[model samples]
Target: MSSDRLRMYLFSSMLAAVTAIFAQIEIPLPLVPISGQTLAVGIAATILGSRYGAFSMVIYMMLGVIGLPVFAGFAGGAHIVAGPTGGYIVGFIAAAFFTGLFLEKTAFTYKMAIIANLIGMLVTLTFGTIWLKILLDLSWPAALAAGVTPFLAVGVIKALLAAWIGIAVRERLKSSQMSFGKAA
Candidate 1:
């Protein structure tokens, strides 16, 4: 493979690994455990842009679904996805995809990244909340209560941090001509 393609492949794989690692670091909550998954997603999207960022999440999902110990609490397999929080797991892909898409379409500014990551978080929250309601036969309020509301404050904070950190990291990488995840 060409050097650039090789770098992308390696970087994407590394991001996938990072996502898995972050998933394990969580604070147990009522329905869903707060985890570092989104932080990793933000970093991946900002650094790799949309396509590879989404691809990295896809890799992480596939690994988890295939019974690897990559999910929160080191749990994995298809069954994990069938549980209450499954939707959020699936939503990670959408989050990464949209976050990356936004970065790709606009200049890589912190403001733009924050907006993109927040939007991505919303996409994730929507999917998870809906799935939670259906899975538990909950009223909309209950579902929102269980899945979305609690996450809002932290989500925004994470989005901002991800944007700042991701952008800064990307800038450093670019200055060094070592942007492993930058699109060729």
Candidate 2:
């Protein structure tokens, strides 16, 4: 591979690792704990755009599936992905893809990132809520309560923080002429 492509792959791998680290930060809830995974997803998308961002999430999922302790509470394995939080984990892939796609189509500014992250947040919640409803045989209201309602405020906060940090870091990388930033 070309150096640029190598750099992109490396960065994608690094972001996956970062997501693993972020997963450790969580606030326990009844069904799903609020985690930094989504924030990491937003940041990955903002910094890497669609392709690499999604690649990172894929890497993360694969690691967890392979029994790596890369998920919340250091939990991992296929069972975890098949568990209550699995939908949210699966949603990370789509969230990163769409969030980066939005920024790629628009400007990678903080404002745009915020909007993209919001869209990503909704996408994740939708996936999780549906999965939760089906997995637990819960009513729509109960699913929403467990999967969506509790996350909105904190999600927004994380989105804003991700936007700010992502834009700042992206600009720095670009200014430094880093290969990953060029691809981003």
Candidate 3:
């Protein structure tokens, strides 16, 4: 592989590793534990674009599937994918994909970025709620209450942070690319 390809692979690997590490650091809440992994996912998409962003998430998931202790609370294994949170776990990939799609189509303004981030998180919540309801056999209202309602505040905050970080990364990447061209 070319040096650039190697660099990209290394960077993607780093992002995946860091994402798993960040997933472990969580603040336990009344309903669910909150982690910075979502923020990392969003930023990864913005920085790495759709292909690499999704690839990183795929790698992360694959690691978990193979029984790596890379998930929250060091939990991992294929069985985890069948748990109540499995939908959300699957949502993470969709979140990154949609987030990257938005980022690619729009200018990286604060408002635009935040909107993209919100949309991304919404996609995640949609899948998460569905999986949660099925896994728990919850009524619609109960599922909303258990999966979505309580997470609103935290989700908003995480979205904002993701947007901010994504925008910053976007700028940095732009400048870095420009510099690389100049050097070339």
Give candidate 2's root-mean-square deviation (CA, Å): 1.2
| 1-184 per-residue lDDT for model 2 (tens digits) | 7888888889889999999999999999988999999999999999999899999999999999999999999999999999899999999999999999899889999999999999999999999999999999999999999999999999999999889988898899889887664535
The weakest ten consecutive residues by lDDT in model 3 span 175-184
TM-score of each: 0.93, 0.97, 0.88
lDDT per residue as tens, model 3, 23-46: 898877544467777777877776
- TM-score of model 2 (CA atoms): 0.97
- List ranges where model 3 is wrong by over 4 Å: 1-5, 29-32, 178-184
TM-score of 1: 0.93
Q: Rank the candidates by TM-score, best first.
A: 2, 1, 3
lDDT of each: 0.88, 0.93, 0.77
Model 1, runs deviating above 4 Å: 179-184
On a 0 to 100 scale, what is the lDDT of residue 36 in model 3? Answer: 70
The weakest ten consecutive residues by lDDT in model 1 span 175-184
- What's the distance in Å from true for residue 84, model 3? 1.0
Higher-lDDT candidate of 1 and 2: 2
Position 83, candidate 1: lDDT: 94
| Regions of candidate 2 where Cα sits further than 4 Å from its true position | 180-183
C-alpha positional error of residue 138 in candidate 2 after TM-score superposition, expressed in Å: 1.0
